[model samples]
Target: MTSSTEPSLYAPREPVFPRRVSGPFRRLKWWIMAVTLGIYYLTPWLRWERGPSLPDQAVLVDLAHRRFYFFWIEIWPHEFYFVAGLLIMAGLGLFLFTSALGRVWCGYACPQTVWTDLFILVERWIEGDRNARVKLWKAKWNLRKWRLRMTKWIVWLLIAMATGGAWVFYFTDAPSLARDLVSFSAHPVAYGTIAVLTATTFVFGGFMREQVCIYMCPWPRIQAAMMDDDTLTVAYRDWRGEPRGKKRDGTTGDCIDCMACVNVCPMGIDIRDGQQMECITCALCIDACDDVMDRIGKPRGLIDYLALSDEPVERAGAAPKPIWKHVLRPRTILYTTLWSLVGVGLLYALFIRSDIGLTVSPVRNPTYVTQSDGSIRNIYDVRLRNQLGEARVFRLSVSSDSLLRIDLQGIPDGSDVTVPADSTHLQRVYVTAGPDDAAASTDVSDLRLWVEDLATGDRASRATTFNGKGN
Candidate 1:
């Protein structure tokens, strides 16, 4: 039933050159850039008092030691579930925010958008605005142009290198790392990481720009599915702006076909063409349109933030539902509830989590050995994890019948076993009992091992099974 002449659904890409604009959105962007960049550059230098043996950096990921330290809290390799929980909470928060307002994260908080904006600021500062830069590119080589281009590249490269260098400082003591970097005594991998990050920052922020959001990044596509009609997005009020005509001696409609919105977009997509995939919702176009409206002596917001479902009638009085209701809809409420619950649960777990861990594995080849004195013996490989920041002595004991006893190969009965902080201790342990005290011959036998901290009287236990041969 389909006609053969219908064109394909896809449309070819068109390049955009957005002109600069200044207003509230621009001011918000400036503040965000300052805050985010400041945090990224300065956080590594902040120190926290974590007693004596641990690194003092406020936040550090000590990969060499398999530890993550954030101020007073420290996490070991086995505590990766905490990290996973944080990631889940972050994902849910993104979902909730996206459901309430479209692409707010992409516009305001995304590192890609922030960095690209910074790079563009550098470009504009050195070269000029859109028109001036376009003209400069078309003009022949001259001293003025050469000087500007050289200055821009130098500044951009320095910022890129600094960005990369600041990242590696989080892994070690920031001041010490800085000294090592300057002295050329840092690890080779550290240098390699800096080089890779610097190259990526330059290439992605300077040249790729909108292409990253459009083709390379997956968020835009995922966001489309996540959004609903009620989500507030930067939209063109097509109902009012349409019948768009040039202002010739006092036009009837508000729009003057100035194309200011098109010129100011960083992604270079005409917002008038409906919500396109490339739009990051930066609100720069809102600033541009407002300026145009002010000059033409017309009411602003020919292009503004509006929900897709809320079609504006010609009459000015048709008010939609309250904005808060739209923001706190069912999907958003669900996401927020889940995010909060998980966050609280993770916090509780982290606060009460044990500082010591015990693991016991029974020998497989010979489940039990028969001693000459009519005693049954079993060998176990025990692993102890010390997650604290200081060395501690722990006593190992077995809990069972009174006739049963436990012994460590090199340690005496009831002797203290010294374990260093943030390290694991592995040892062979033997458990013996009189034949009368031994449990019945069964595939599974109940066994419990307890480790007690001698300094603080804190104790932890593990429940395992002692396998035995059939009688």
Candidate 2:
């Protein structure tokens, strides 16, 4: 049995009501939320004019066919290095931003932040501002509260559903999938994914907003490693605003302890308490405090973006260094240089990639078969990949330093093989060496198998060994 006298490990959460404030930071947050949400919810609907062989969606992840299409670019399974490079670039970019600006990604561009902001906006519209929300939370259960809560939840569910639906649309043709979804004829996986995502999004955005950032996310812990004394982050100027009081006496600091910064915090922590892991550095407190400062005829920036390296200098009544000086340090430079190198390499590879691909697999069960005409023949299974949208004929040929001849099993002596649009065709290939050729008769001979697109004249080759009768 649990003892009531022992301190409880879990503390009951006190819901935070972030009061609305207007300033530059608030406007910036609004714009960022709009852009990020717009991109997420609308990108799947954008169309591109690919040929009839491919989906018209501008961005698609065709898992069934193992293709990723982005406008003019098509990524095959073999080209997954491009995806890896992109992920590496993203990580480097995240590190660069964290070292320079401290959790700016979490504050402004994270999907969690964006969606939570959206949910909060909806709540405010239905239940009024911060004070009204607190009152509603404390008031006794009644019809008005129930109605408002239900209305807000329903809106949140709709948004969550839309979010899930948009994600699945990226995997297939959007319009067809949408029709199937509406008709209840979509795949069971689609329905299940949507249901799961909907539940998580609704819960995360609406109920567990700040808790997710504080406890669930690992970034708050990992960010400490990425930060340094020069990292610019949201901070309280305790030197200028300390020794708190209600009245502006000579001994009283600028703080006045009005609780404006605390009231505006989404995470329900006082910024004046110094930096904490829970802080996302959203800078809404800056907006709130600045408004208070303006009203009371005091200087702004009681709460602002500051670097720890500048604190002592600023406290001694000297101006801090410029923004670029903090941002262009050695660590950031290294990240930028590495990020640029990877980007350039990816671009180079994308530009130089071939339109046709060839892979040759030797059939070694019988090794080499001796022909009736005193010759040795090696058999190979050659796969020809056609990347173009239209069907094309590919010519096959073989070359070796020694005497050798190539032949395709079904095609006539000189005729080419036909491959369908954007597909791979496996063909049987035979490389023969005459009895008089010493290289093939005694040992394995190096052979180069070449394939050429008859229409585009693009060529690719694979190197294999032609086994000899003696070996």
Candidate 3:
């Protein structure tokens, strides 16, 4: 129905087969992949001794009880500001790293990159490297091809399942969850989350790969804002690489146009075409180009980790700038300062936080109950939180306002109120104003409710008001 002049918005996917190459950058990528994947698949299994009152898992999100435990630190719902501070620091950290090193996190630590590299390793192992993969793609369908394809897919499925399972472990006790998963006894939500994550991992890692970096991720679009002239990124030195051909016949510059860099690039971009948004700056092209340069008996770094600021300098015949010259500029300094301040504030708060907490809510249905002795009484709901691992007795007092006297509903005047380990105790409290004070005071009296741990002397307080009538 459309006119021929209208161009199609969708472009068909062209599969890329990245060639295997050996150089320093390639070795660095291998180490990064190993460490990142190891941390992801193994962290949930780490244990910490938090006593019997809490889970021993070093990192856990106990959603049912509204607690987040990270090793020695346990966070309550009221202290969520600590989590917010951490999130802010994470954002600033990203900005700092992005400004300093172009897409380094994307290349090294991102789960997508790590998993995609793993999938590619499997593919190369089964289907052979770059050239063989290209040939197989064009080859006719047969038993040999189908067998290899099935084997690769099965291996990918196992990895995806493991990835999903590791994520679910963060929300519960890992060993128990593993047992429950095998026995089909886990909660429906757990199973649903695992299933969904498994599907996404399989699709994203095994099939999508670099398409995720190019079209799916928003980081590439925003990364340009983080870059400056002095920011280091993988680059092709066209000054040395241009006028391309082999060297022996006196027909070329240093670059032979052998296409080694293009073949090894996972994003399928020509680094020689200048910087493109599609480049992940993974440095694989640098490895490929350097390998080719070495073979051709030319100085390496035809494609290297260099900065745009150096390009003009090199062209003008000036000495190259030092590596750390512009790295500590205003932007990075501001980011680092902000990140450090939040971390320090959170640490201070954690160190000074008390093990006892108190909250009070006034009951308003009757407002005031006139006592038989002509005194005024107000009912309140008091909640006492015990953060320690052992049960303790807490004494409640309400003496800030001279006219207000406090009493708990169920307990006799002299009895102790006991709070269980890591739990809250709720009591209906009464505030009474004697006839003398009620007769002389205003309609409302502001009062303070304080709770002290009888065993440890830890204390906290909340302020409230007592209703009364004055002449």
Q: Backbone collision count in every prediction?
A: 2, 0, 0
Global lDDT of each candidate: 0.84, 0.91, 0.85
Residue 239 shift from truth in candidate 2, angstroms: 0.1
Give the clash total for candidate 2: 0
lDDT preference between candidates 1 and 2, better one: 2
Candidate 3 root-mean-square deviation in Å: 2.1
lDDT of 3: 0.85
> Candidate 3 on 1-471: residue-level lDDT in tens?
346998877877889999988888889989999988888889899999978887899999999999898888989898999999889988888888888777878877788988888999999999999988898888888888898889999999999989998999999999999999999999988899989998999999988988899889998888889889877888888877778876567666788989999998888889999888888888998888888878878899999878889898876878678778757778888889988998899899999987877789999998888899988888989888887778889888886546567788788675369888888889888878888884225677778888887877777888888777666
Tens-place lDDT digits, model 1, residues 1-471: 335798667765454555778999999999999999999999999999876888889999999988899888888888899999999999999898888889999998898889989988998998889998878777789999899888988888998999999999989888998998999999998899999999989888888778888889898888887899889899888777776888555444676778888888889878999988888999999999999889877799888888876765323547766678778788898999999999999999988888778888888668788788766778889898887778889998887543467888888665468899768998788887666664524445688888999999999988776654446
TM-score of each: 0.92, 0.97, 0.94
Looking at candidate 2, the ten consecutive residues that score lowest on lDDT are 437-446
Pairs of colliding residues, candidate 2: none
Candidate that scores best on lDDT: 2
Please say which candidate is ahead in lDDT: 2 or 3.
2
Superposition error at 85 for model 2 (Å): 0.9
- Arranged by TM-score with the best first, the candidates are 2, 3, 1
Candidate 1 RMSD to the real structure: 3.8
